[model samples]
Target: MFARSLPIISLLSIISLRSVSAVDYSETYVGCVSGTGTSGALASPNVNTISDCNYACADAGYTYAYFQYQSAGSYCSCKNVGPSASEITPAVSGNTNCGGAAAGVNALATDYYYNNCYNSPTAEDTTSQSTFDACFERCTTYTNAFVSPAGNVYSCVCSNTASTGTAQNCGVSGTYFAYAHTATSSPSIVERRKRRLSERLKREEQTRLNRFCPAGLEACVIPGLDDSFECIDTSSELESCGGCLYGSTGNSNASTGIDCSTLPGASFGGTTCSAGRCEISACKEGYNLVEGRCDWHV
Candidate 1:
């Protein structure tokens, strides 16, 4: 009798272990549930339904699971432990009856939702859909719960009506511009013009920097003016004008070089740098520069 009882106890222990190992498919919840880091976790792509999520978790030997809502579908995440009682929202339940419901026609402006991925191409819609209304309508046609007009394009994304997904943790402020959802709102003309102008200015600056100059010379912008730049020969421009005027020190005397004012006895006038050296291009009326000095001629 004692030996038979020992076998029965062992069998009971085996049954208990099996029960503990079984995955609980019904313990789903919202939020980014996890331990300190990714310690007992598995992620599954294209998990559209709860069953898919649970199956993926079970296959990966995890006991708990959750979904990440996105345009493509719900991505599944499997974990070893269920969310804490504090982490679970029992009142709000999963959409067991997703029912593939089409978007309603009477959707309100606030109902038009979107996730902020970033201010890059992911944030803006660069498509031909010109207005937020058009983009939202496109979303409704395909059961997409969110429409975003960012990056100057229209984008429609799938969403889980069950829960609001985690907001993106964009590091920068203001760069993450808001998405367009207004029915009457079209793409921002002002924004488009600003972008075009910025690109044009960049190109123009590059062209100026590439202007032809003698060897050892480079192009630079003039000081105090937008659109004013020149190829500079630092070795010869007036010592003050040497190098790029944009940032070169304007000191007139540097022992090795001389500004227009410090040219021997010649008065400051038409003086220019030819390669990396200075030359008197012209003289004031009634004055001629001779032997590094200016003389008045009758």
Candidate 2:
């Protein structure tokens, strides 16, 4: 009876040893990536059912994964998959069971090269406000076609072939985002022409104000006043200028007076010209000379 029992125990021991060896040994080969489909060692790449793929990587000690969809079927591998594993570096010619063994490898290599080579905990290229804004705009338009994954933020992965954009993980946290519209031109010439016209109108209005109003009174020109001028008194002019208008009024005690010295390129204590076209020399302090008239000091 002990002999029979000894055989049984020996068989059990062999089975146990095999299991331990399987667990201890590491297998390297070219296959598809698995879980998260993002970048970094944290992502899982075991090719299995989404759920199984999720756990297979953990069981296989891999954190990242991808699934290579091909004419035959899907295949999976861990982070260890490489050209040497299948005797086919990305440079090698001919086809192999590995998805990256064909001419298509160029595109796949681009994706893998960026995702695996530049793995970072922070968003890639998101160092400035402008970059963030541009990336955000692209993400908004492209939606999920590209992903910038949160933790593996160095590169973006394209979801489908229809997507014509790249993923940019902008930010310190490796946040994944998509950026489309590369190599695309800007608005058409007609659109630019319209924008230029609008800008020109603004400049014209500003030029008119500079020609007529006191130096600082440019801000006082109300919007849409194409050909209108208001005869503002000294106090009103001073308020518009944010201070007392520098210039002597013909009638110093007069409540209403125009100080031309406030105009540009005028000298202090210059001529004073009122709204009625009356002019006076030797104006009060803060006034300036402008075209033989005392302009308000700005």
Candidate 3:
């Protein structure tokens, strides 16, 4: 009895495993489904046909390929998982025009193209449907995503209903049908632009601030003038020897050099500014040199 039970248990386990796993029809056409692009799946729009859609998915290494048609337009997307039962909206047709692996397709006025095997297209959309399509699936924000072709990657552009030319056939990378489905939430594309703009503004403001005085130099008002100033090295200025001779109000963290030659009681050529302070080498007969200053003799 124990031996018989073990065999039955093993067989049941095998059946369950087979039943639970989904089929891998990679590159093959299984069937279609319903709804818009797969929820949160990497998707593309304007793929030419289901055939191209299949290659697009396979090339992108997704488990399944999803092609959709609605009042807006046709779209293609790759997903690792098949659509939910609610999204299994099919449009059965006996037409095999696009060279699908199946004899007929499930195309309808509004369609959510899908397959049982689960992978989408891997190859480029031979149709003008690509370009705005890739590095392929990075732009899955709102449905109005467009692209600017650069080196090897794409500059995905984000837009909404407010953007112009929703009906116009795309003319940037190639001629292609257009689709529009504005989303209420902003995606990476818009967020990235905002962050970059903020960074640029901060940089510009810093540049303007530093223009008044270079890093090591100080901006000093030219004494009797209102709107004029001069750049002075505060660490060793002779006139503004120890610090700025006169400064209106400004950065609490800047050096202000003083004028050593302007000290009273010091004769010409008797006093000199060195380092950042006034030094008295010799004083007039009426004054005595004390420490570094020219003091009056008592």
Tens digit of lDDT per residue, candidate 3, span 102-217? 11122111111221111111222222222322311332343443333223333334433223433321212321222233243324433443354344445444445447887766
Q: Which lDDT tens digits does candidate 1 get at residues 71-144?
A: 55445555544333123111122212112211101111122333333333332222334443454444332322
- Give stretches of model 2 more than 4 Å off: 1-132, 136-179, 182-184, 187-270, 273-298
User: Which of 2 and 3 is the better model by lDDT?
Assistant: 3
Please give the distance, in angstroms, between residue 143's alpha carbon in candidate 2 and its true position after superposition.
Answer: 15
Each prediction's TM-score against the native?
0.21, 0.21, 0.28
List candidate 3 segments past 4 Å from native.
Answer: 1-215, 248-257
Ranking by lDDT: 3, 1, 2
- Output the number of the lDDT-best candidate: 3
Best by TM-score: 3
Minimum summed lDDT over a 10-residue window in model 1 is located at: 1-10
lDDT of 3 at 212: 83
Give the Å error, residue 155, model 2. 5.6
lDDT per residue (tens digit) for residues 133-199 in model 2: 2232233322222333232221333332232334322221333323233222212322343344344
Error of 2 at 192 (Å): 7.3
Can you tell me which runs of candidate 1 are displaced by over 4 Å? 1-147, 150-208, 222-228, 246-298
| Weakest ten-residue segment in model 3 by summed lDDT | 1-10
